[model samples]
Target chain A: MSKDAFSNHPITPEELPQVNSQSFTPLSNTYIKVNLMCRLVFWLMVVSALLIIYWQPWITLHKLLELYLPQVQLAAGGFGLLSSVYGILADKNKGYAIREHDFSYRSGVIFQSVVSQPILRIQHVELKHGPIDRHFGLASLEIFSAGGAMHTFAIPGLPEEKAREIRSYVLTHSDIAAND
Target chain B: MTSYQNQWLKLSPVAIVYFAVQFIKTIGNNLFYLLPAIFVGYNQFSENALIIISGLGALLVFVAISALLKFYFYQYRLSEGRVQIHSGVFQKTHIDLPFERIQNVRFEQPIFYRPTNHVCMLLDTAGSNKLEAKIIALPKNIAESLKQEILAYKTENTHEANDQEPQTNEEQLLNSRSMRDLVIHGLASNRIWIVLGALAPFFNSLSEKFVKGIESFGVDVDALMASSQYAFWQYVLFFFSIAFVVIALMALISILGSVITFYDFKLTRSDDRYIRRNGLFTRHEVVMKLSRLQMIALQQNWLDRALQRVNLKFEQLNANLERQSAGTSGGKIIVPSVTLEEAHNLATETWPNNQLSSINYNPVSKRLAIRNTLIAFWLFVPLAAVLTYFEKTELATASIAAFILSTAFIILSWKRRGYAIDDNFIYLRKGLIGVSYRCFPIHKVQQTTFSQSWFMRRFQLCSVKFVLASGGQTLPFINARIGEELIDSCLYQVEALKKSWM
Candidate 1:
């Protein structure tokens, strides 16, 4: 009932123990969009956005005037630039991240968050391609976490072969019957 | 209509006739309607000539007839591996749903459905949304036999723990309910909803009468406020009079609605799941796995708080959908009349490992109090100004001031509600009299985010939102430090090697 109850007995948030002990089974070789395919796809979304503005000037011009867009061209350019700068700076945040122990990914700007999961949780992995990705022989790898925000993660564009490889690795290690 | 192969399976012919008579009186209320139609057809609005008169009569007759037949043609049988339900009038349907796929089966033999040895049964799971897939009226004996076979099958095939697609769903339906539970829930939980239903007619009349003079269209709340001062206290007294009459008129309607909704509520447990069934003439059954339940929500309002009652709602997973689930909800709730202590016991019993905490002790930020007070003033400014200028009444101004002051007090109280986050749990409380609460295990958190706007940053405040598995808990903006701390706890949960279902 008093304010002191908080500071007097605060709950501590500590780092999880990570050692090879107990009945823990080490998850197999599946980088959560860590492979080259994801990085490539991520680049492709940015490139496509840029390309559309260059190719379809009228729509862009209309959008620019109506103030319908969230951020201005300058702001978009800034966020895009910031994201790229962050990507380059992402290695510091790399660790283990997974949806359902199926596929794990780790990347961060100032702070690193790594998630890992077992193969059973990897309901499905999808490789999506846009016109630009198709032309560039690149694809984006999206890993479905099955539940919550972990349901899907995007690695913009990767080489087709690498995407297929990651998907295969996840499927082999995981035991999710395809609903289809 | 699908021919009831066993035509003798019809619900009591006598009871059916009796209910039909009630139905006819309720729907055929316009028997003299025909006499008026011929007389008034060319005398009034031609645009709605049919719709306002003959069309409505025909529609009511059609609905009443359909209600009668839907009651009449309803029949079922239990075969070797599945059950059959034959219903509908012009268009016919004969379903042969296998026993293995039937998630959980429940039967309701209401006083009426019972007399004919007939019962309404619901066969549900996460698979389909067909209307009949959830609610099907079947012969009581056939329904019992079907349930027995399914239970026997579930017992025989208990091999895999994660048998995602089992040939048979193992959950059971609430078969027994005491009359006391119904009466308690009816009296305790549903008064406000009933009140709103009762006030509908009065609201329509009051809104049109007060507002029509001003905007003459769309609910111009401004006009209504302006009109309120016309008779001063006298006009306001008339409004209360209107409300009183509306309350009386709505009381019966509200009671009937409650009776229909919670007619035969029964809660049953099978294996590791809880199932609930309720509804009078139109029975409904919902089955949920114990582990699949995501979060339990405790809601109290001014009325409930005074009565020491809390409405319990459960947020379930997609896998736990009933045949006729509410409002695109992936959540299932048991809204019973319970005290704070009882609610806590029920919540803990349902989730033993759940790390739940009460509202943490803290003084709210002065800035939060100030901002809310200012916001409340902003909201009522137009009303305040209008009354001050046109009505030139001191009571009006005092009333507005009192409203603003009371709102400020609530804001101050809400700030005191505070928030607390332990390593594996987060708890929040809000509101005045009712004091709602929500708790969750961090590991079950989907994602958590910390966001701040320019204004929030200026106030040195930010919000940390935890997206839990249930879609139930909503994170409130607290002091910035606590928000960050909550996020850290969730992060810790995600990274923990030994994960407990949060």
Candidate 2:
């Protein structure tokens, strides 16, 4: 093996080029409301299920609930409150950028990350709307590449029409570079 | 053009049988809990033969009807550089897959269809979780013709657009394994565990059959066991013989499995595609495009190192999940039991103009060894102390020995952890008992992550994970700065490269 293959340059994170996500257009602000609503619905279901089980006549666990219900409620309430705050913050932090050559997305509240995939490398784009999303007139645009199982980037809570438009644009670009 | 427009067709009549068999297999796979019930019912056939037969006949008839319906509904049409499939009786699904998006076209002829010259055609599209189309049983000629048409369309579209011209037209015979090598591979493969696990549930039945056979031969096994228990040496001898028999059986089973799977393995390259053909009974022929290859892994276990042999695996994009779960080689080509020189030759042939020797690897920080040792110590020391407190000296001794052995293994693994990066490719080599050296083209890297935990941040260490199109590779316990640099350089290279990944 040639010794020159190894470089003596010192490694540092500062040497890496910083990616500015501010250049990207921010997602719809209503996304935060939608996210909060989803979280609230999830917690509501859990709380209701607990209440239903606790209130069941067949159950002989009155004493057990007296001992555990307060503790469980405190823990669940604390977790729900913490997650609600995190969810709103995360939703605010999430944004996507589409350039002439590539697409980029910035995500994560604490450990921030910006990932970019070249438009030419994209394999397909999907526009999905769940029942809740449909009611809210919101959709998620999922971009996939020849890469592994996970989607390259999924920008959720876009206006349904906007998501469809982005999907069509991605489809066209991906088709042009399909042979790759 | 008129004939092509009229090419929409359903599968052959025999496809019903194939579909029925497939249905049964899928049910048997998913409904594993029902297997014991079925077995019990089968065993009581003499008592309830009429009822069991009638019930089984009804189930078979139901399966046949469903299969017939599925075969009837499934229709495929090929025209205008696109393959369209229409299937499903209730919620119909229509798929229009362009030739350019089709990553692979696999043709399979089951042994049952050999006489009828029928083949199963599977069309895999890029980025899709499931296959674009599966034509269960079509005439062999039609399937082959469709495959050629799709391939020709894809090549014509991409051939003229490629910046880099074709290297050569000459076909090269890369490597072929002999019968002797196959046997060696069988002996080397650690597949005995799979056989043993699969047969565990049937062990009782098998032992019962053995006992019955011996009794029929007038050998009193119960009396022998009772008598053997009275003498210490005899009991020791009996257990030793049993262990010997189990080991022999396991080895035989592993060897046979390997031979069946890897018989007559051959690899050949023509232009930009590598073709691998193997298998003793159901021959599998897989063709992979060189451009689509995501990673190449060279593996050598302790036994392999002792035998001076290695296994080379080539991973490609979008492997079928079902096939992989079935323990079949899916979108990966394994060249087993080749000498080191042969492996090098194959690697060079696959990536010509690249110096396989010039890449330099840098080992991870020595702190990794310390970290590993600390982890082993924390995990085992408490267990050993508890055992000692309980006066379980034998268990405590075993735990202490395990702690030592594991610590040594981690240190060895730490010594082996190294990564090398070049302008074109990134190489990662690690492992203790079995070393795996992976080489991935820089352009094929889809994502790069440099993550640090609180402990790692305190120690100025981090782990870098590279998610390639085929799979993921990680370099753990490296200097945080180095991880960042590596991720940045890889991303830069990936962005700058104009070449296609897949």
Candidate 3:
């Protein structure tokens, strides 16, 4: 095939549907509360572990606290505040968009990423919810493409009905593509 | 053969040897446990040679019995458009593979079975990373007929008639390798390092014995080492001589291995597929359908570049990405030691529209070097400072030198990184010393991802990743707008083409 005979009409960059241009739907509001609750549980476990260590016979609990309480408080306080801020920012920035021919998920605060999988390329779709997610009436959608052991994109913090709808839609579209 | 199509059949009794080899392989798999036992036995029973001999004899007998049992239990049946295999001694299994699901059928002729005119048939399925089935010791004519029957069934069942043309018996030779070419490939490749790594654990004892052997030659190695009578130049020359000998030996071993593996290597085309026949001791035949090709990789190391050679690999749509990248995928075909012109010709032949030599490559963003050098600065500065504070001037100098070298490497690698896009294909080239070119059709991309760090966002640069059935390839530090356009274009092509990437 010669270059001239191949008749190439290049698509204008502006005309192409850009992944970064799509308006993503934000995750449910309860997802943030669930995140806080999970963080609280983790902190509670850490405090319990510290208490167990403090309960030892090396020194009196009050005396040990007197020696290291301020330092520990400072470290934990700084970490907790930063983590809460980062979590809120992440929740604000993370979202998903389903286009006619493909779907994309945007995530991260500092290291942002947008993963797009064509409907024709998807192998399967799955819906999952953990105990906390179930308590909050939230679910996650996992999309897998061929050749990969892990899911291509796992969108979290979606309402159960929305997640189910997306899963069904992907399954139908993928089935059509497979049949074709 | 057709009369017994639906009935169970037994393999030749010569399969017992194959099974016994498999038993020995299982023992090799347990070498970690056995190595320690052997060491302890050597220490404890070194005086009792009879005990060790009897132990080995008993092991051989056990292996023979197990092989016999396994051979006795094995059976297979070829039903309508499918093959059923039943095997195993302690844990029996029955496998039924449809013609459409079997991705490839390969036949291997081990030297041991050559006298008996038997071959081992391997079935590669779409659901597994490794060969799914191995029917050993099949008579040559029966194996050939079985292969034809399976191919015929596959052609009938496959949906894409445009690509699944009926298989032709005619074989047209496409390429063959000479012994000189194989020798160059052996020297240019890095398989010797893998061999050395596997032998490293035994090197300590081996070196000690080597020194003792030298002593038996009446050379006072210890006295020569302890005495400072030799000049520094003499020591350097001695070290160089030893290094030279070791490298020469390793090169010879690597060349021998290459010859054994690819002695009479040949690539032939039959209909719309390619067949590669190679190996001296264990002849191997691999068939690859053209439509299943996902990517073509051409690699050149420093030595290969100097020798004007390129190593070509045709990567197919594999079931597992991890195994594919590990070079263990069942569907990959490697044609080693082709010239640069031949490589380009083959690439153009495979993908007619994508002329690799004509495609203009665009280098990646310069920020890659800046970001990495900045990272190195943050990492090595503190180490150098700490070393200087500890009064280790020499170590500090070395760290500074390392930082400079790393920064240079980063810049050089950044210069090497480039990507080009044609009408229907995407090509990526990257390396520090020896470049590798990867090309695949745009429609074969299964997924696309564009990522941005805070620094990259500030610079309006992002990295793009494309996931194909073979594996994922990344274009790092490209313009964010270009990255977005590439992803969008890949997704669009994949949706519009509707071509089966399998």
On DockQ, the leading prediction is: 3
Ranking by lDDT: 3, 2, 1
Error of 1 at A123 (Å): 4.2
Please write out the lDDT profile of model 2 over residues B1-502, one tens digit for every residue: 2365548877788888888888998988877988778677776777888987898899899998899898889898877888788988788999888888787776665677878888777777765556467778878877766766676676777566665443454657889889888777877777766777888999999999989999999999899887744788878887899979997888887778778877777788877788777776665666788888988889988878889889898888755644662114558888998998898888888886444445778999888898888988998999999999999999999999999999989889988888987667888999898898889888777766555565776888877778778867878888877776776676655654446787
Candidate 3 or 1, higher DockQ: 3
Point to the candidate with the largest lDDT.
Answer: 3
Q: Is the docking of candidate 1 incorrect, acceptable, medium or high quality?
A: incorrect
- Candidate 1, A1-180: lDDT as tens digits: 123334333344433222111122222223322433455566667666755665674754664554634344456656666665565445333433334333445444433223334344344578897775676666767765435443355554456776787777676652443211
Ranking by TM-score: 3, 2, 1
**Highest TM-score against the true fold, candidate:** 3
lDDT to native, each model: 0.56, 0.76, 0.84
Cα error, residue A21 of model 2, in Å, equals: 12
After superposing candidate 2, which stretches have Cα over 4 Å from the reference? A1-65, A74-120, A123-143, A154-180, B1-5, B8-35, B42-44, B48-77, B84-96, B115-118, B136-146, B158-171, B200-234, B325-330, B354-358, B383-402
Q: Assess every candidate by TM-score.
A: 0.58, 0.78, 0.92
Order the candidates by DockQ, highest first: 3, 2, 1
Predicted structure 3: lDDT: 0.84
**Which residue pairs collide, candidate 2?**
none
